[model samples]
Target chain A: MDRATLELKKSRAFLCLECGKCTAICPISRFNNSYSPRRLLADGLFYGADNLITNPLLWSCLTCQLCSQRCPVDVKFSEYMRDIRAEACRQNQWGNASHGGALHHIMEMAAAPALKQNRTGWISDNLKVKSKGEVLYFVGCLPYHHDFFAKDFDYAPLTAAVDTVKILNHLGIEPVVLDNERCCGHDLYWLGQLEKFDELGRLNLKEIEQTGAKLVVTSCPECALALKRLYAERLGGVNFTVKHISELVAENIDKFEFSEVPLKVTFQDPCRLGRYLGVYDQPRQAIMAIPGIEMQEMPHSRRGAICCGTTNWMNCDAVSKQIQHSRLTEAKATGAQTLVTACPKCQIHFRCSQCGDESQKVDINITDFVNIVASALEG
Target chain B: MAGKVSKTKKKTAKAKFVPNIVAFACNWCSYAGADTAGINRVQYSPNFRVIRTMCSGRVTPGHVLKALKLGADGVLVSGCHFGDCHYIFGNYKAVEQFDRTKALVKTLGLDERRIRLEWVSAAEGTRWGEVIDEFVAQITTLGPSPLNHKPKSRK
Candidate 1:
């Protein structure tokens, strides 16, 4: 192993004791026997990356971080997978995009400093947002999703984006909504396109600084994580505060009016929100504050929540759908009318899973938590 | 290509002859108006599925587009009369969102006439009934929504 690879192995992967605990808890491993985190690590440690990188199973990992959670030896298989993915992307060897790289191309284009996107044109006039405020709401690739997934997914994507602003408005805070907001480069960083991710981070930080917002807020956990954690690590330290919408909503949960619709609902914690950022209670606290509403527990709730599956627009195979189908079945079994999720990707993936094959349909409504709060707000 | 063709075939086979209407009724006025219409026993089309939001401004382009994509033959958004919004300017936002949603749908080549936004106040029970009758008549004439035959992505 190279020095960088060896350092990662020593600090993380080398500690693996081959307990198979990660594989046991893995959602993909359960369905697809050919790909196992433990076996992948074993192969890497035994034969090395040169041999293992050629294996197609390398792309199949969801990187949901369940293995690290259950691993007795604290081997972060997801991070390891991310590192491997980055290397493969550098070599131009990666899985196919389900959308023919349209989304990836958009992200790649966003890395440029001169690209002026007409992306924010979709911001409806009803939203009371500005280019400068004390708070900056980093609108990520949501506009792209708005256009791309329009035919397949509901206005759920755009609804989450707009409701996020509306909820901020309800909180008496008019967010600095940047029309020139660039992608957070989360997809790039995770896909191993590190320099492109750094450029985007630099570009967004420059734009956000011009607004002079003291706090940065976003509905997308991926963007929030990238802003709060990765930007500081890979680029430089961000001077401002970055918070997911749920955190801010939980802080102001007492101020909102609650509604009587969908009295009982369950929350699907996104892997980034739940595991990456440790934001579990904020979503629930906001949910439970609504009058006559109850938050149901999915069999896997909080830290144990199942991932919506599919990652970085790569390796979206049958296992992704099976994972989503299992999670939705679990959600429906809870008898909750709606499954309130904090991440738009979760809603999109869950909805996409339900789109194909009517047999996979479960009788539960999938919605963003911000939408729920926005809908339930009385005044 | 095979999957796409099969999907189209399946959609046409189980088509609903009746229009599937999704209505966004504002809470303070239009929703109350709907209640009054029910209380008065005013007959209207049974195809309408009403979702009550606090204000019409709460209805975004996504909601209307989603409704249409989910096979809604028509989406009717009713709220407090202009300048009469319970929240002062919510109806205006609804109007803004309605126009934007309509534009986006038309740009996508879907029929713009499938969506209608109106003002129905709390005391407008008769008006509520008439609106439904009119929207149903309009949708029936427009035939089923292009989205109606498409597969539903929501679970």
Candidate 2:
């Protein structure tokens, strides 16, 4: 059998019962009737891999793993989609990349072996950090996002990194911050550029190993997922343990002394942190630790959480806008003053969805969960 | 003995590198500026290649970075002066894009001088020639781009 067929067998796509559970729950399938995970599996099974590979709908899968979570027979639909995308990438078939693929090119540039990145300029004098230590804070692509989004968006992306370090310092842990760190390659891996992703992974792993860090903490859930899971699964394995900032904060919630902010906030569970890494509760726990804070849970929370409209910055269209609009409306409906997210991309996408379109605008303040924790820290 | 001397001289000459610059010139201004320079017979460095774009804003960061990644020693984005843009505010957009592109380029460890944004009008033919000559010279001094190398064979 061909490799694509083998992937289908390995991911248990053949065991699909045509239950349409995946389709019914899919955020994309709700707005886009043409996209269905079950139908894609059936097409691969009956019509063969070629039909499945060439189909444009193949790129439409968000790979958010919502389907796999709902699948009874344990069919890893998102993993199946990832494998197929790798095949498609090998054939030079790229999806309609948003932002004219500028973000992808940035990742590729970061993958260059000889690159001497000056990525750590955001480290302010106030935050305590070390050049090498046992705990390394992986500040991934936040600086780039800060530069790229500075013009239009009022949101400061780098504040998440700064706030993370502040929270770490408050916990009496001065984490190592590397100056020459490459991207974590989460986007590249999802986009099926496995070769570049591997290159980036190897480079990042070498840098982290040099720091002698036993624990890797990241504010961005995508970076955390890549370092913790994708690196272990794809690039042999890493020496250090990876933790999302939420996990670290949650583990030491008792150590923190927070000021009374008295704000009602709702959490957006990033798919990578929630489903991919099973880190649903830690972020909520950390948020609740803030004094005088009221935590309102969205209707679709934890495993059932809807994705933040898009993934890997691909296939962003009207459906993505609608999903974002609906998600924002849901956050606003809970009577929360702020919609706090654990992921920077979530904050960016939600803010981006509110731009330009007056009719689709949902009035809500979006922020990173770390920013809240930092703000609530008692000096 | 004479051949050895000649070989040493050849090595020294090879050290005098000619930079490969990929210039994105806007059609309304910079591209026509180049034409105006040619009409005026102004002399400039011939090492740069010009790719005419509809507007300087058309040259996204992806384009500039792709050129460098594919072995461009330097990239020059030339557009209309502020308030002189044919598209009203296309040059303003170009400035914004250029700022972001420069930041990314710096983050990637390339010399920020290797990538530049300049305002040149069609009437400023001599200025166009001067920009090219100066940018090419600057890139040469900075040496070849670190990203300049053969594409690695994928595993």
Candidate 3:
């Protein structure tokens, strides 16, 4: 390390005693033995950009905060890696090639009015939906982008969401449809593309503002949290309210009834919507309100919930898989007939990993909370 | 008359030797603290140039790098204390970025002494002055960044 660089690490190293607790509990290390948090920190402190930019391990972190949670001194190894990744980006080093380019492509698509305005078209014609209302449903990109490539993934949820809008219509809660709704920009920010995030945020805010819709509901937890949190910086002068569709449905629980489906269900909390954004109770309340359904808790629930490995924002393939496997195993151990999650990303990732393995045999039913609520409504 | 004459001459020399410092104060805390300093007349170095931002977390590593790259002799980043942020932990995020960038800067052979992080609450205007005084003195001792070592190739 250069003298100046060493001088800086002196402080960082002073605070970080190299206890290796970060490496010990790291979920990434469980799958890929090649990943060493101790080495990454040492390289960062000793080698600077040389090791960080060149090492494939630097980009292999899922940033699930598992290490941060376990660290005794709060060293924040994952965030340190994020800085290294940011520097790599600045130097034109394409660390994770798979999803990095796709982020830019998605941003371009999100900005186009033609594409954004037709977002609701992803729903089938058989799903009866009305156009004007005070509530607007923002169905996020996963179901639209991946289609049936995900396992046990049903587009029937899209119909259910439309059915939710119809139920609201029946209740005299006129919901306005922002057919021009693009992404709420969670992916762009998570992908480390702040500029693209700003553009997408502006577009979404503009479209949402045009609707004059007081209540914004979305099927995606990531989008809900992003709209509620991230846009405060991006659109300083604009203000609006956002709610997950489940939260909306939970608020209106008395208006609906369940047919007592015999299936025990465990709910998966999306990271952005849960720990990262602090939306835990609303989703759970919605799940529990369903009559005759036994609610099961995953070993890791709420703020401690692990992210699905397929976060377009992060590029830690090895660690993400490790987390996915752990979460799937835990959810399966609950003996719930189905594993349910609110985010489309979560739905898609779990489906991809299921792959019909007999040992890991468990039925995965990926459905949004609103879909369940809409279906349970006593027509 | 002789004592008055000597004091005026000393003041002029002290003013000429004081380092000129520029600060990018986040709007939430540091900027309000500077305003507090002005209201309280804390008398810090007039050397600082404060640019206000909504949150200190908004300060990207690129901004700090560019400021140093663009010839700011010394940079001071002040934000709400950890957990006290108006946006709740935005400054903590800034803390993470700064920790790495500060480390990165020293690695690139830059003077690590020229950049620092300080937490100044909206009520701590005098603390802001004290921080500026310390930063200005440190930069004065170190001189301009060595990154300015090379002349523009195009020029």
Q: Per-residue alpha-carbon lDDT of model 2 for A1-379, expressed as tens digits?
A: 6677777777888889999999999999999999888889888888776677778888888888988889999899888888888888888888888887788888888888888888888888888999889999999989888878866788999999999999999999999999889999998887778899999999999999999999999999899999999998898878889999999999999998888988999999999999999998898998988778999999999999999898898989999989999999999999999999999999999999989978768989998988999999853
Question: How well does each candidate superpose onto the true structure, as a TM-score?
Answer: 0.70, 0.94, 0.60
- Where's the lowest-lDDT run of ten residues in candidate 3 chain A? A143-152
Mind giving the per-residue lDDT tens digits that candidate 1 earns over A109-134? 56545445565665788888887779
What would the TM-score be for candidate 3 when compared with the true structure? 0.60
The complex in candidate 3 yields a DockQ of: 0.01
Q: State the DockQ of every prediction.
A: 0.02, 0.64, 0.01
Order the candidates by TM-score, highest first: 2, 1, 3
CAPRI class of candidate 2: medium
Best candidate according to DockQ: 2
Q: Clashes in candidate 1: how many?
A: 1
By lDDT, the better pick of 2 and 3 is: 2
